[model samples]
Target chain A: EDKVVQSPLSLVVHEGDTVTLNCSYEVTNFRSLLWYKQEKKAPTFLFMLTSSGIEKKSGRLSSILDKKELFSILNITATQTGDSAVYLCARTPNNAGNMLTFGGGTRLMVKP
Target chain B: DAGVTQSPTHLIKTRGQQVTLRCSPISGHKSVSWYQQVLGQGPQFIFQYYEKEERGRGNFPDRFSARQFPNYSSELNVNALLLGDSALYLCASSPGTSNNEQFFGPGTRLTVL
Candidate 1:
């Protein structure tokens, strides 16, 4: 079975602080990894990492994948209250078609 | 263009009851997928349909079934619901089946009593 595990199940930080979330996966055929931010109901797309050592960035958020280690990290710099949400990491296997196997997610709480 | 849309944003059901949730994909999208998100857990893939045909399915029980329409809309039906069936049912749509990112709906919150 394909499995994805995220570290630091929950985190609390004040505004302006920086936080890093981790995700590691074990799958037979890894194709890509994706990150999402969920506030209330739906998760919003963040980044999709396909190649190792290459980083994808957006605003204060950036993510990098390490295919060699089968892990990824999401970094949020200068975190704001609006950044408080669940960060989800998902993996797409080559054989799964388009199905995404997601990690349990890391709950981030940014205090103002 | 509008994002993915789901009908009956919320629902309440009792044990042994059946429920059907609807989803309308984003304009021009041809693939739709269903997921179940239990509290404090990540969303689990249930089914994926493209061109009105079943493309993939997860490990969910036979009680869970889905179908897509010609227009790209879809419906998920769960029969003989148990309390464990209560969760947020999310519908996502993508332009095609290959390597495309999916856009999610607000999700239907189902509570089984």
Candidate 2:
């Protein structure tokens, strides 16, 4: 079975404090890794990483994949209260029809 | 353009009742998929429809079924509902085939008593 595991299931930090969320997966045919932010409704896409050692960034949020290690990490710098949400990491296995196998998600709470 | 849209933002029903959830894909999107998200867990794929055809289906019971309209809109119907069937039904849309990014809707929350 394809599995995606996320670490530090829940985290609490103050404003301006940086945080790192981890995601590890084991799949037969690895295609790409996607990151999403879920607030109260649907998840909003953040980035899609398909190559190792290459970093994808959007403002204060950045993520990188390490295919060699079968894991990925999402980093949030200078965090704010607005960053409070559940961060989800999903992997699309080869020939999986683009439907993703998702992790349980990391719930981050940024205190101001 | 508008993002994915789902109808009946919330619904409540009793066990053994049947429920239908609706979704409208984004303009120009041809693929639509459905997922069930129970509280405290990630969404699980239920079905994927493309061009009015069933492209893929997950490990769901026969009680769950869906169909896509000619306009790319879709509906999810669940029969003999159980407490475990109560969850947030999400619909997502993508431009073409199975290799592209997907845009998601706000989801329909169904509660079974």
lDDT of each: 0.95, 0.92
| lDDT per residue (tens digit) for residues B1-113 in model 1 | 88899988999999999999999999999999999999999999999999999999999999999999999999999999999999999999989888878888999999999
The candidate that wins on lDDT is: 1
Residues A34-111 of candidate 2: C-alpha lDDT, one tens digit per residue: 999999979999999999999999999999999999999999999999999999899876774677778999999999
DockQ per candidate, 2 decimals: 0.75, 0.64
Per-residue accuracy of model 1 over A43-96 as CA lDDT, tens digit each: 989998999999999999999999999999999999999999999999987864
TM-scores for every predicted model: 0.99, 0.97
Docking class of 2: medium
lDDT score, candidate 2, position B2: 85
Off by over 4 Å in 2: none
What TM-score, to 2 decimals, does candidate 1 have?
A: 0.99
For candidate 1, what is the DockQ-based docking class?
Answer: medium
